[model samples]
Target chain A: MNLEDYKGIWIFVEYTEDKISELTFELLGIGRRLADKLKVELSSVILGHNIKCDLNLLFHYGSDKIYKLDNKHLEVYRTIPFTDALEYLVNKYRPEVLILPATSIGKDLAPRLACRLETGLSADCTELDIGPDGNLIQKKPSYSENDYITILTPNHRPQMITIRSKIFTPQTPDPNRTGKIIEEHLELNESENWTKILEIIEEDQEDANIQEAEIIVSVGRGIKKPENLGLIKKLSSCINASIGASRSIVDLGWISHYHQVGLTGKTVKPKIYIACGISGAVHHIIGMKSSDFIIAINKDPEAPIFQVADIGIIGDLFEIIPILIDKLTIK
Target chain B: MKIIVCIKQVPETNNIDFNPSDLTINRSHVNGIINPFDLNAIEEAVRIKEKFDDVTISVISMGPPSFEKTLKEALTYGLDSAYLISDKLFAGSDTFSTAYILAESIKAIGDFDLILCGKHAIDGETGQVGSEIAENLKIPQATNVKKIEFHENKKIIKVESDTENGYRVLEVKLPALITVNKEINVPRIPSFKDARKALKIPIIKWDLGKLKNIDKTKIGLTGSPTKVVNIEKFQKKKDTKFISGTPNEIVNELYQILKDKHVV
Candidate 1:
């Protein structure tokens, strides 16, 4: 397992219903950095049915070589056939590092590939870097809601890591850039696999994915009464923002589980995130730490949320939100 | 049918504190329990076992020997058998290495129809190990499964998976891996019968030697492809500006500040 024997960094480009997940491109953004750090070629392993049109997008996202696995078996992302194709390619090329987006399919596929290869894989990594010794150092929040743990697999081969979505900014696609495309052929029959995707029923699209929202007004425990949420909602509506909440508010049943934001909750990187009376815990921080601008409105000045906020208002949210709404209407 | 549910002992996050000097967590004050998601998986296994009276559920985990506390906790939940994979040599494994060891251990146990795991470990959230185990063993896997049903005659499994937008139905065969979500089922508290039996049963403990053909290179830090090159504790900046006024006055002042900041 000499590091030198591994030559390229590979991204598992995932797609569903013929559309690529945004997480795939986000991984490319981060993968480009790792590729640059290691001074190796950055490539992508695209497995899907009729993905000829998708190959160009891989190069635009910094892949030097696109290893395309096109077959009907890969059409719906079944585990057995998809893993077999990926394992075949890995054994042939022997990539030094493999990166996958922590999407549902990627999460399921990456670890299985690592097992077959008898290598190591790091899951849901928030941060990744190369050590001086050339080991891929992965930093993830550990202890099931505690502080961050830095893990290094000094002895592993073809280091594997799955990164969460929105943690890395996607690099702008450069249409002018060009790369080599190498298509791999699968040797297995589709009928032999044990799993088959019978149907894919699409859900109604919600407008409230926190990562895409420009403005977010989040409620915490400090709102006092659950009825007080109307005031916060009115304020959010006035600003054309979505409403979010810390885990405490959700646990208290003030809001639905979908509104909760934290490590176990949804990770939001909104441009403007307003915290109402939420005492910032590390679990909550990991979810919203990437926000472009953070505003904390808590009566306690010493609350941890204030530490990460660009603007700190040491006042009760109940008293402040209505006034803020009124003032916005004036303009 | 036999099912294996893998669980991990994790520090309860609600009470964790950071020691500033070393950037490590202060675990002394924290309580440990089975990871919440893993608990959901264990509960699902129990439900499936109950449906098929002949089924047996085995709970397995890989951590420090002290993590046996979590296996006992699983017993209280009605798991029929328990095993702990612990060795000083297995330290510092990334998800890849973790899956490698777990897959090897599963192989040693033999003849399991289904494997269950949490969608992602709360601490790492990498969600890579379960799928990796399926890959290592070359089995089918469905993740973020909210609902799972087995069709006995056809040997097909109907799984409802959580997608970015909604749910999708997938059909996989037995000897597969399924990672469940918290929405699947409410885990039951252990009955007195199971609780007492759990206390009486001894959990099987294994070291690296029990696994067959384990390439040491792929079992620990050596087999891992990733490493943490460096760590810098997140530093929080102090805010100097504090607005103090009567409640009404403070509201007005906040209004003005919001206007100035264009946050309204």
Candidate 2:
């Protein structure tokens, strides 16, 4: 009933060791656009211990206000403490919209916060907009298949949106932009923290992180038998490209699902994506469509993949792949 | 120790095709299977049951009546009991409502020391329901669990879960919820004999009428605060050009295109 109390838009800034997460800037970029359209101020929340970062750093990213919860217990990324800090800020400020990343910490915290506040949180969203009736329109893959679904939370306060990484481009930092930073007060105690972080060890996740690679040479079922995959790998290595596979290739047991690139697999936005023996199914196309340059080498002239490729080559990959390995020898 | 692992039936994606007209998956042509991560959760619970002398593992799923088959399959994996929560009211429920009903059903099952789930359902992919259930039950939660250990006579549990950067080891008190990732363990396949014997046991079924003290406004699509407003089919770019030639000529052309794109 007190809808007027809820105003500005807020971004949950996930930071560590004085470096802000890239997703924060991206949210700020999109949040600024949304906030401007609604004629509301864009604010950010920072929770950390002994935090010494320059508050003005956020002003460059178009943030109009910053809410700080600084305490010794707020240093590391603990679930309870972080969630409590965020919950406290939202309940008091009553922001109309809140955005967070779909990272591990965000994934753990957002759902709990939404439940605690009795609001709705949309996860892994790729697009966000304010609807005509002022509701938040959340766009994301339903996670079942390749199609995008638009979701709206009309009744929840601080309508929450969790966005996946690399979904949006961040804006350039402007030195002239200025804003107000308001430090908040909070009562912190160790007893309230049930989960204890004894150690933090980063896992070596080099396998699927290839989605971040510059050049990727991916193979599909068109590569045929599992043994013939050697030709695809040889070409990838010749160009110093990462190896990727279509869902069918993985399903056929030719490669691990970790190398799968499709709606069910990882969404890759590489610089150069070479699809070898790929028929360009929609499932495979969505994953690599963002590539700056795509070249499809499928024997079928009518393969759907050529539609998205910059240059479509209709020929036998069995012969062309070896020549590709020899012609552009990166070594 | 009494543990509950929540799983779901997901449409096997490989055989399904995207309906270009409405941008929805054509599920009529595919079959459903246990969510991949949930199988990891079931295996972890089974491993725990094997380690302890007095442990009962129960598997729960919220789906249509056909999901009774999925619960039976869970029993073949060594779980002691199975529960299926199906209701006309639950047909269009979102994540929050789904978590609420599951939490209430877990409460009805009585005291439990552990609750486990897949980090995210393959279909919804929100990765939120498990934590939402924890919130509804007012318990601690650890997500993306890759490794877990019991300590202090099962008074507390320590776990190392995967994160975007790597992994973090955290210790939480018992009677908590955790969502496991795929790296936990390789799930065991259901044996034909175990599968057959498992189906002989009657599955516990509960509908909205059976669940007590639940707010009706929060159970189905009406209780769900979110709605899908639009579904648009993906349209590929049409400006691409085709090239056909001898292997040498095609390679030369591609090499030139890559150079022009500065794709090297």
Candidate 3:
């Protein structure tokens, strides 16, 4: 229980197809800052059936050391083997803090590790800082995304947190930076994993979700019918923007689940978000409220969406959208 | 086969607002609803009971005594029984501590075949409890279970769970846990007839005294590794500049603003 035993900040360097994920680099950016604030070393952990991943990129990002478990058993992201290997590494080289990207792997593994270590872990933290006593100060939106709650793992050694993607920008790669790479022998065998990845079936989904779109034209119940979506599409095509919808529209089967934008849906941080006819429930607002420029057009002046919009036009979206389309086309 | 479904009661999200004075959630201002996702888990349990022979569904929740309201609501879905693990000491427990108490409850129940939970609570959205509970019980766990099928006298359960990368069809042994989302099945509304009958079934309430060998340090807010340090409203430019006039004038105004921002 002595905090002195855990002395370094560690980032779980996740990989996809032999390349490091952006979240790993983002954590490195924040992780390095935390390490500096705590006056401790920064390290990265990678456990994969890897033969081809490069380690230099990790150091270039921010890692002072890399603790890796490279073995055939570690190739797949089965819960048991990874936990066994990670638990061993964490116990051997105890960390003051452990940060992981809130990807599926991290979501599955972080809790198991924390449970084994009997430590506290914050999930989907958007903001993190070193507190006055060297504890982790983590902030995340509460269940409804209505308010942000700050969390601290004050008493636990190796305080854990899983941060959401895009919360932090990554540090630039410094090719000159060098770090130690410590490899561990995988003690876990295949027999330890009770569950198996029967088969991975990746569907070819070409649609651009609101999360990655630069410009999103999102709609809500104000659209009279599914056909009225054409009016919004007209504006999107004119301005080269993607289509997004509120949960009500998606639940009506007017659009697929992938295009829904809300707390129950995808979180989007687009450059320009156009809310047409959307009443702006707290759920829908939280998803796209982070957009750079928001323009809300609705007949109801008091619609909540207008509260977050930079420019609020109180009018019928059916009327406003067509006129805007004409203007954009003419320009 | 005995199935245990984990459910949680959370604030109705639609009306959630924060206190400006202290950025923390003003829960008193918001009404409570059984987490929408947990309803799906309860439905899956009911559906499994209907399909299989000699199957009983038991629902469990950890919260204040009032949480029993949600448990009664679940019983209306035709579940066999319910248990409320409510205790003042359990307050402020994080996902880990919460999972530990549930795991202990499962062990105490003994002779259970399966545990099911919603993928995540909408309020917390952590999605960490099922896996952590499985780890504590040393049972296999699967998340995002889209479709699940039991085979060979319920020795193994086949599941198709969605991951960020793709869907993986996994087969895990019995005495395992699976967390499901909306993709699994449509939750049914409780029938009035069943609701009446459900009200008659006395709910077994377990407090800290009921759970034996419970470590005091690992049960409540004290045992929880995570602590809430602060709460703040996530910032957004809330005030807006309304563009008034005719539809034509509004469009013209929007175009000029877009032009100034170079959004065009």
Candidate 4:
């Protein structure tokens, strides 16, 4: 385990539908800072089939170089093929640090890659920094926002961590910046492959995609009956806000898991997050704490949601939602 | 057919208590529950067993001896056997070491046709164990699986795996691993008869001594590559404006605030 043999910092670029994921750019944003601190070049690793995009966009975001692993088999995200390609790349190049997004695909690939490489990986990290001792310091919530554990891979080469999205602001794209693109090829054996994609079904785009919503009208256990979701839908429609829910209601089958807003679900940061009847647990709070403004309406004054809310209203959601809806509709 | 379902015992509540002195979970006073997602895995395994002929399911967990209680609860769901891999040396294992230990333990348990686990545990929520186990065993994996079906030949399995916006139907060969999502199935509760029977059934215990050819440096805290260097209580200040009034007044205040921000 010669740590010195590992050099540059690498961010695995992820793509969907011919577009690079926004989370990849976010990693590049933080990756730039860490690379500069460690005095190493930052690179982007992209694997796919016939990826038709301007590679300069990555350099614009901040990458000194791009490694392209283009193969027909690499087109789809199967765990083994993707992991095998990355394992080969990491072994050949020996990057000092590797960062990935904590998305569904990233979560699946990262652990498998780390295991094959025999390295360390931190998951869903909220923060990354270079320590005084020159180790990459990864900070993640230990079950709650109030408690955080700082992790480091002191002896491991190519330290790894999966970061959540929207945590950092991507740098403005610089047209003047350009980098070299390196094309790498590896032999992928079909016999070693164990999974085959039979079909893909993309759900219709619904107005309830709250991750990108500007305003969110979220409900919780306080909404009581499943029928009460109508009231929330009315408020959301009135304000043109997307609907979100705490895990409790989703667990109760009051709504689809798509609307769930919490740790196990999607993390959202809308401009206005109106939480109704939500006694926010720490798990739920970590997902939405970054919202620009939070308004919590709960009967219990001591609800944990109120602690983080900019505006705390004490009342029954059933009573208040109708009035609020009526008031907003009149104008 | 043989199946191995992996489970973890997590704090029953989200308000996890931490030891003030060491920043470790203060497990002394906390009640544990089978991780909610693992229950889904158990249910999925049970459904598979019910659908197949001569299928046997065994549940395994790597934790303190107290975890045997949770494993016993799994048996009430009609699992064939339970294995507990516990040792003082396994304490403070990160996901890497934890997965290594489980893979070795699984090897000791002999061969299986399939492996199942929860998407992730709530306590740590790393979600790395299942994938890492597959990697160690050199098998393929599908995560966030919503539905699964064995082929007529019973050698290839097809599943509906969840993605961000949609789902994909994938066909995985036998001897694969999968981590199931909560949407997979509704877990059943143990009946009184099964509960009583489970209490009498003995759970197999395995320690380092039971696992042959085990590497000493790859099973515990010292073997873990990633180290927790520091832990601190997070603090954030918010100047909350508590609104007090009638429903109409509250609505008026909120409307004004939203209007100022052009939210309406």
Question: Which candidate has the top score in lDDT?
Answer: 4
All candidates: DockQ: 0.50, 0.63, 0.62, 0.62
Off by over 4 Å in 3: A191-193, B14-29, B235-237
TM-score of each: 0.89, 0.92, 0.94, 0.96
Candidate 1: regions farther than 4 A off:
A16-20, A36-39, A52-57, A127-157, A191-193, A224-227, A251-256, B17-25, B152-154, B208-217, B221-231, B236-241, B256-264
**What is the TM-score of each candidate's chain B when compared with the real chain B?**
0.93, 0.93, 0.91, 0.92
Q: Which ten residues in a row have the lowest lDDT in candidate 1 chain B?
A: B231-240
Model 4, B32-140: lDDT tens digits are 8999999999999989988889999999999999998999999999888999999898998999998999999999889898999999998789999999999999888
What is candidate 2's CA lDDT for residue A144? 64
The residue pairs that clash in candidate 4, if any, are none
Compute the lDDT of residue A92 as modeled in candidate 4: 95
Share of native C-alpha contacts between chains A and B (below 8 angstroms) recovered by candidate 4: 0.80
Q: Give model 4's docking category.
A: medium
Full ranking by DockQ: 2, 3, 4, 1
User: Candidate 4 residues A79-112, lDDT tens each?
Assistant: 8888889999999999999998888889999999
- TM-scores (chain A) of the candidates: 0.91, 0.84, 0.92, 0.96
Q: List the lowest-lDDT window of 10 residues for candidate 3 chain A.
A: A203-212
Writing each residue's lDDT as its tens digit, candidate 2 over A96-215 gives 999988788899999998888887889878788888888778888655656578988887787888976667767898999998878888986665336999899865555456567888
Judge candidate 1 against the unseen true structure and give its global Cα lDDT, from 0 to 1.
0.79
Q: After superposition, how far is residue A230 of candidate 3 from its true place, in Å?
A: 2.6
